[model samples]
Target: MGLEFNDETFRGDYTFRNSAKAIARFPFPFAEDSYMYSVNMEPHLPGRPGSVFEHMFDVDEHYVAEMRDRAQVLAEDPLRCQSLPHMTLAGWDLLELIMESKARDYPQWFSLTKDGNRWHWINRPLQIEQSFTFLDETTLPYGPMEYITRQTQGDFTLQDQRDDNLWIEAGMVTTQADWSLDFDIGMSFHEWHAPVPLAHEMRVFDRALKFLLNLQLGAPVRRFNWTMTVDPLLDTSPENYPKWGPSKTTMTPETIGHRQHLRVELQTLHRLPRSNAIVFPIRCYLIKFEELVTVPKWARRLHRVVRDIPDELATYKGFIRNKPLMLDYLSKYDDGAPTSPGIWPE
Candidate 1:
C-alpha cells in the first residue's frame, strides 16, 4: 500500500512585518536542498539551482581531501553567474504586528537604512502544514525521503526561535477502535515583507480578499476542523536534530515542486487598541487532493492557475497534438480517452 490517509488538512500561515529588504526562501518538503532565491528582484547575476546539495553529497571528499572553501562556491555557476545584491533574511520582523509593519517600506534598502533613519518591521511568523494519507507510491516515494517525522498528534507547539513568534504543526490518526493521533509540529521565527515583490506594497485588500475567498469559483464549502488541543513544552535550547543552525539536509529543488493544495484562515487586529477586527479569508483549493501532483508532461501550456485561464480554456479541439489541463482542458467534448476520463478533445 502507498501512503494512504482518509483525512487531510493544510494550513498556510503568513506575516508581513517588513515588505522590502526581507527575503523569501523556497525549500523542498522532504529534500534537504533549496534554491534560495531573493525576493528583492534587484537583478541577481544568476545562480545554479542545484549546486549546494551537490557539494554537500560529496562533503566527505570536499571537506578534507578536496575541501570546499568559500572561494570554491564563489567560482561556481549559480553563485558566480548570478549577481544578487546582498540581503539578510530571517531577522527583524518584530512580532504579531503584521499589518502595521506592512503599512510602510521595510528593510528600507541599504542606502536608506544607512542614513540612520530606521524603519520598523514586526518580525512576523509564517507556517505551512501538510498532512494527509497516501494510498500508493507509484511516482512518489513510499515514505518521506528526508524531512522525517519523529512523532505527531500529541502536545504540538513550536516556538519562534529568531523572534517572539510561535507555531505548531500536528496530525493524528483517529480511528473507530484504537484511535491514536500523529502530530508533526515545526516552529520558527522569521521576517516577512523583507522582500520587494510584496514590497510592491500592493495596497489593495479587495483583490487579496478575492483570492483568499476563491470568490470567483462560486460559494464556498466550509469545513469543520476536528483537532486536539495539547500544550507542548517550549523548547528554546538546541541540541541537534530539528533545532536551528547548520543542518544536514537532503532537500533539493526537485522535492519542493508538485505539492498538494492548501487552506488558511486568520483573524487579525490593528494598532493603538488591540481590538477585534476583520477575519482574513482563508485560501482553499477547489481541486481534489489526489489531482494535485498528477500532471501530464504532454500539456505544459494549460498548467497555470485557473484565474489566468482565458476564454479558450472552455474548448478543447485536439488531444495528443495539444493536451488539456486535465483530459478536458476546454471542459467540453470528451477526447474519448480510455485511460483518461476528463480530457478535452472534441
Candidate 2:
C-alpha cells in the first residue's frame, strides 16, 4: 500500500498526531531503564520492513507538512540554510546522495533520470519536477543542500574532515533540539559540542570524532539523541527560544500527558563520496506522552528513565522544570515491571 501522508502543523495550535502505525514505529531511544552519555554508535544497516531504518532516508506520514514547515522556517530566517563557498561541491554531493537514495528506495514517490550531467527529478508527494544540470547551481531554485533538504524531513549538517577533525561547515537545520546551526556553522567537532555536559568530560566526543574521521564510504553510522519538548514544536532552536520556551511554564498536571512530548532524534552520519565530507542528518521524531504510553513496555521503561534520570542531564535536556509532572503522568502506567533489554516493544 502507498504511504498516507498526514496533514498537520508543528506549531500554532499544534495539530500534530501519530497514527497507530507511527506510534508502533516511533524510535524510543532508551535501551535500558536509564539514559546516559555514551558513544552508542551502530552500523546504519537496514532493519525490519515498515520500520524507519528500512530505507536510507525514512519519509513518513508527516513528510509533506514537514516540508511546508521547513519552507516557512527558511522564509522567516534564511540563515537556517547555509553553505560555505568552499562547501558547494559538498552540497552537490549531498544532493546526489539523497536523490539517488530516495529514487531507489521510494520509486513511487520519487524518481530521478540522469543522462550524464543532465538530470530530471520528480517528487510526487511534493508535486515538484525539475530538470537541471548536475553540479550546476543556476538551474535550481535554491542551493543543492537547501533544495534537497527542504523536501527532506530532517536537519542536515555537512562536516568537512580536516586537520584530524570534522569541521561543521554547511547545513540546513530547522527542526533542531535547542541547537543553532548559524552559531555553530564554522566550529570544529568539539567546539560545537562543548556546550553538552558530561559528554565532553566523558571523552564521548573524542572517541566519536576519531571514529567518524575514519568513516568509510558506503558504511554510515547512526545513533539516537533524545530530549523533552513542551509541545510538538519542530523548530526548538535557540534562535527562536523566546517563541516556544514560555510554553514550558504552562504545562500543568492535567495537561502534561497531552502537552509534553518525547523528542527523539535519529541521527545518521554518512561520508559524501565526492566531497569526502560527512553529511549528518538528524531526523526528529516526536511522540506525546499519552500516545507513547499505549505501548506497555515503552510506558514502563520511559517512566523509569525519566524518574531515575540525573538532575543535571534532565536540566540540560530542557525538561528539568517539568520532570516532576512527567513522572506524575508516566508513573501511573509503570507497574514496577522489568522491561526487556533493547528498545523494541516486546
User: Which candidate tops lDDT?
Assistant: 2
TM-score of 2: 0.99
Q: Tell me model 2's lDDT, rounded to 2 decimals.
A: 0.94
lDDT of the candidates, in the order given: 0.19, 0.94
Those runs of model 1 whose alpha carbons end farther than 4 Å from true positions after fitting are 1-249, 252-276, 281-346
In model 1, the worst 10-residue window by lDDT is 83-92
* True-structure RMSD, every candidate: 23.7, 0.7
Which candidate number has the best TM-score?
Answer: 2
lDDT of 2 by residue, 1-346 (tens): 4779999999998999999999999998999998898999999998878888999999999999999999999999999999999899999999999999999999999999999999999999999999999999999999899899988999999999889999999999999999999999999999999889888888999999999999999999999999999889999999999999999999999898898999999999999988999999999999999999999999999999998888889999999988888888999999998899998889
Question: Count of backbone clashes for each model?
Answer: 49, 0
Model 1 vs. true fold: TM: 0.19
